[model samples]
Target chain A: MTKYQRIYQELLDKIKTKEYKTGDYLPSENELMKTYGSSRDTIRKALQLLLQNGYIQKVVGKGSVVLDSERIAFPVSGISSFKELKESMDGTIETIVEEFTVVPADDKLKDELHMDDGNVYIIERVRSINGEKIILDKDYLNGNIIQGLTKQHAQDSIYEYIENELNLNISFSRKEITVIPATKHDKEVLDMLDYDLLVCVKSYSYLEDATLFEYTISKHRPDKFRFVDFARRSQ
Target chain B: MTKYQRIYQELLDKIKTKEYKTGDYLPSENELMKTYGSSRDTIRKALQLLLQNGYIQKVVGKGSVVLDSERIAFPVSGISSFKELKESMDGTIETIVEEFTVVPADDKLKDELHMDDGNVYIIERVRSINGEKIILDKDYLNGNIIQGLTKQHAQDSIYEYIENELNLNISFSRKEITVIPATKHDKEVLDMLDYDLLVCVKSYSYLEDATLFEYTISKHRPDKFRFVDFARRSQ
Candidate 1:
């Protein structure tokens, strides 16, 4: 499964079956190296893994264009997981786990979980989908490196028991985002009406040995948030 | 300026003079290879240019940490320019230019500017900082690859006249972000009475030959937005 991951899974199944739609273009690294007999550095490594997974956008003399695959609606530009953003959306998600404790680290949670003194855990949650709500999260962790968390690991999936039962490794994050104004605990947990904004986000995470260990926030519901991203310009 | 850009400008001036504050750490790479007699791959290429400029966050066995130098508020996570984000804040920044023109492309501006049916330009503007009106923008471009745009290049700096008088090379973007509710041309241009959210963004850009040319949107005013970012975990 590697001739540039089989031409990046046959151009991501012909761009999810729209048969290469959104502004078309693709097909010319010498016509995808003579239709996949390959090599123009394996069709530019399958168009640089479809331009790093946002599914195509190269464009210069115009080659790999096709973007707008619903521009990944609520993707929050990487470091995913909430069961991989609820299996990339369709509905019926849920979640709930309202609060799980441990506490102790104040001083703004020890400078927002850079952690130095002690005790941590916290949690919260809410989420939901085809039945409204729309995110809330909260988290915190780093109680001496995430120990014994339960409440069925925050009703299943505390990043899948912190990477499959504490093997750890999670890696990076740093987010931020903003918007604010709806608290009263987001007007009592979620389905906000007359929505006076909320978005928020925050984040921090880490740990592929560079441990900073979680620190979330989440929030959303400002018309059910969205993010996407991609960037590059830094020559 | 080399020797890892003079140790990344003396650790970005000791993290903007908090004398290495926010979550501290730094120092070791054999103590900056014995205080700069250098090597340890030039202090890990000056801490990978302070973790690619968000200033610092390494942390594995815990080394380069010091982040939160006001984690770049309203930075809109890169692909900058509104005069490089009003020369990174502390502000007077204005702009105005309400609407420029050119037109034609319709059909949702030729699939949101992937363009194939000529004529484009557009523009619009607003911005501001010390004098209030948070932001608005609009843009579009690609009139056969951005030609003679004026209104004094939309009140000075249409990406510095597309990279110094149309030499053109801009490069990357994709963005998205969201929020909405506030248009009446954002409550008649900007300070939305006690804000009913706005944020927006959208984007597209491209160019160092991979041309898409442009497409924008912008918006803001959700408490003058903020974005940040920095991700990584794709393993």
Candidate 2:
């Protein structure tokens, strides 16, 4: 393997083993060059490969820090509150909410979202991995969950606003996931390029009172999606 | 919707809500005709739809029972014991262990399976869903896990055979899953009818003693493959 490739694997292994965790600043190029005995160009190329693979990110003045892609992954088991997950992950992960509006809830959605009657707030978002859009979430929340919703609030993580601003306790939830042929709407929303199927993660979140807070439908590119679990024989 | 469609949905809802669990025999066809106030043909059509959609199964002498497809699913937090999961739910989820042979362990396999310059037994099998081949699994087990291994011993769940037959504690695991363009071997093993990408689930299973018992590579056709999770925000 090439010197650069070897460095890349070494760095990846370090990250996987949590030797370098999310939000931890990596050594500068000059320092890496000195330590690895590599040329400047070789060091830059290796860093670039890691950056492109969602391993690390660079800031304008600040040095490169590990990205939190693995930190917020929703393992396939029970549901996760996106807000709580981000907060516990140290709040470094950011959200760019794109759209929010109140619309008439349809029959299917009414049942799924558990809306009593009337208009519901629909929030749309593009979740990013170090600034690159990865998850396109479209949520239907009961209007009663929050009275006033704004475009600005929608741009960030809704979970943040829900708990930090609205003070709602996200207790538990369930999810049903399925694979479907990509619809034209999914392509437009998710900007999927090469994948044929769209993995749909449909989940319902509830408040501590057991009232449904939001029902979300997430469309992810098949290539970038993974759901992992550990299992054993039940004695 | 037709009467049969309505009946199908009603039964599906019952199954989803656990009114009818896996292995619970459904009411007889004549009984269903009375309950739904529908003709025998309508009831039959509803049952047929359920079978096709993997909701229920029919036994030769016994009546139809709900099929627990979700019961044996991989858990998000822990490893799933396929044998225990199958036993928890009704119906015989059979595993046909096809091939068992020993080969020199590769460097990567050695690292993952915790082997050191030793022979590794490779086990290959096609897991069927109600007699229809669905999953193609290839496992590299440490020769030390099962002292004596032959093709016949692996015909059922290897984990079961290892634990009950040989007494090994299959414990926690880590996994990495990805979607890749189907290879020629994938097509042959999965018997792919259509050209599409395959979702690969790869994991290393560990014993309680921390010895890696198996390294698995399972491939599934996208349509039949699903990984579902309900994640709550980290506390």
Candidate 3:
């Protein structure tokens, strides 16, 4: 391996092995430079490799924070928030805030977020493309980190508010993509047409410190959704 | 933008605009080298970017050929054939050949394959892990290109035969990943316990010369399927 690849692999190996566990910050750039006896650019290149490969995330004030390694193993493609994903496509998109409420963390939310007890923000939004409600997103967020999430944030980009306004660096996410028979909730919110099945992308999103900040389930109409990929023959 | 990045984008824009249409080979490396007034290595770097980003595919005797740009827009992840995909996961996998036959391409097949009239080979295979069948793959191939396909090839790896033995380069593929209600055919082939929905990945694979060579639909039990993606917050 080249120098940067070696550095990237070593850090990744340590992260995967849990030698440096999740939410743990890695050594500073100076420390990494000293450890690898490499230049700043070389160290940055290695760290960038880790970042793009989803092994770590760069926080504004903090150093590189280790992300969930298990998620790294299963990535199908690059991950982007809804806004970024849709902005690239040609569409007149609108978000409808169906519901926004803050409630005390239930047992399930407490367990999922790994928190003792605190209020959680629940935001439900329906995304319409070309005047059709094709996507429904239900987000459960830790109220502590994402304080005072307004209906505007729910209607717009929640990730934008968390990252820009809240000054928190959103890190990696563990996503589970599946197709399921639509529930009553899906039927009530989405333009279900005649399709019985829908695609669901459930994401457990973490912050720079690897705190589980949000749990989002985005449901899509089957015909309106497609996950495309490119492949070259692997040697 | 960096020089290589600029070159990559220019080429991509051209391809997307159909300035260079599909099935059209890109300019020779020497021609690009002269047009850009760069070294062979620098020219190559730009070409490599095109190849990786799914803009073009390299053939053995031919140069880089443009891939279907529309499919490039919808890519959810990297495309890997079944054998490559399953081999990456932990499992004692087995493939059972259910059926293999060659028949004249019907009108639907003719339209799908973009060929006037020719024989097409159909193969159905069941993929099992440990003991339970979890995946059913149906493949249709242009018999003129994929000549002399055998039961052993279907039982093993068809891509392997097409690449290694047949000396035909498997190039880029346009993929559609969706979840659909299981058909009666699926019920007969797969050991579907109770799930009514399944994840279907439809792939239209091409050869290096940009020839439509194969079309495959692989169905997986939803619980057994997950498409993961890694996203660094896009700026």
Candidate 4:
């Protein structure tokens, strides 16, 4: 470990352990330099890593202010949905309900959902973060259980409606993630003309009673796709 | 849900419940068609999904053979290491130790590992699956703790050596996943001419005592990359 790295680890440990709580400004550069006996360059490098990792924000004149602990974390993701994660990010997020309709399950759609013959609700949404269109979400809901849905429901949180209003438990999900080329639809909608890759996370969600209820494919511009995980060794 | 999807779900449920055990051949297409009153195409479609999803494999002389339950699963990955997952996959996997040397920790290397000044072991390896070079794994070990590591250890499994030989309790890791354009090294080493995208999983691993000892960057060709996750709702 070099001087900057040692300082980074120590400061990060302090931040995570709440020795430096959220909203508290970190010590000035001079203070950190004096404490570590590291040069100004070394201190700045440590602070830069913290900023890049979203641990702290360098205010123009107020030094580095610790961000919300829950809003940011050691890893950006655990088990949160796009809406949930975006809410924590506190960015200017907007969900555009591009298309919301009910259709008799086609063979392909039925196959994807593992269904026989029933109506399904389709929701096509584009997610813009910080004024940039980065994610396109396509969802298929079992219309039998989800008897009613509207654009308003699509714009807001559909999961919230399913769990709260419909009183269903969102138990678990199986997600298959892959990176693939951008499709025509993605090219047209996503603001990633220069970048050619997209990270697709296709999920099959189940209810508490073991009912497979939803299938969603979320396509994100590669640069905007950030997946972080914390894995505890399984016994 | 259509009739075929319902059948798919039922058969999948049976396979998962072990009603259709590993090595137990599934009911014939004729039998399934008769039982479900579905057409041959529909039954074939359902079986195709089963095959695609790795539930069963078709044999020319024999019917679809039930696959190894653990070798194949509902989702491919959980908390397993690359070797662990590959072994379960039953693939002919080869790990070539390209470079294994001890380097004085440079500032960048030290910064990545959060260290001040110590010797660090660099291990560069290429992973081939079924004869195709699909992954490149670069590992950095904290030489201060590892003391010594040989190329033979890299050829086998570093984690295994750490646990069985060194008696280190492997704890947890923080992983960051992203998709990016292939680098020059990636293009030169990986046998992925047609594929231009790469999925990168960079990890920082710590010991049971919270000693950060390992840093790894695993680069994979996009088509060969499959990240499956199972998320249980947290309270």
Chain B TM-score of predicted candidate 1 relative to the true chain B = 0.33
How do all the candidates rank in terms of TM-score, highest first? 4, 2, 3, 1
Give the range where candidate 4 chain A is weakest over 10 consecutive residues by summed lDDT: A69-78
DockQ of each: 0.26, 0.18, 0.20, 0.26
Judging by DockQ, tell me the better candidate of 2 and 4: 4
Write the candidate numbers in order of decreasing lDDT: 1, 4, 3, 2
TM-score of chain B of 4: 0.68
* lDDT of each residue in B20-83, candidate 1, tens digit only: 9877887888988888888797788678767765667676675778777575553767688888
- Evaluated at residue A110, the lDDT of candidate 3 is 95
What TM-score does structure 1 among the candidates reach?
0.33
Residue A178 lDDT (model 3): 76
lDDT of 3 by residue, B63-174 (tens): 8777554533321345566677666667788999998999999999987776888899999999998788999999999987889899999988998999899998775565
Per-residue alpha-carbon lDDT of model 4 for B1-235, expressed as tens digits?
Answer: 7777788888888998899987788888888999999898789778866754546655545576665445325333534566677765766989888889999999998887768989999998999998999999999999987875898989888888888899987865667788777888888888986877788998877666556799999899887887876555643
Question: What clash pairs does model 1 have?
Answer: A59-B210, A59-B211, A60-B209, A60-B210, A60-B211, A209-B60, A210-B59, A210-B60
Error of 1 at B193 (Å): 21
Among residues 3 or more apart in sequence or in different chains, the pairs in candidate 3 whose N, CA or C atoms overlap within 3 Å are A75-B228, A76-B228, A79-B230, A79-B231, A228-B75, A228-B76
Name model 2 segments beyond 4 Å from true. A1-98, A127-134, A230-235, B1-78, B81-98, B130-132
Tens digit of per-residue lDDT, candidate 4, span A1-235: 7778889999989998999997788999999999999889789879866764556766656687775445325333534566677765767998888889899999998887768889999999999988899999999998877777778989988988887899987865667788878888788887986877788988877665445689999999987787876554543
User: Sorted by DockQ, highest first, which candidate order results?
Assistant: 1, 4, 3, 2
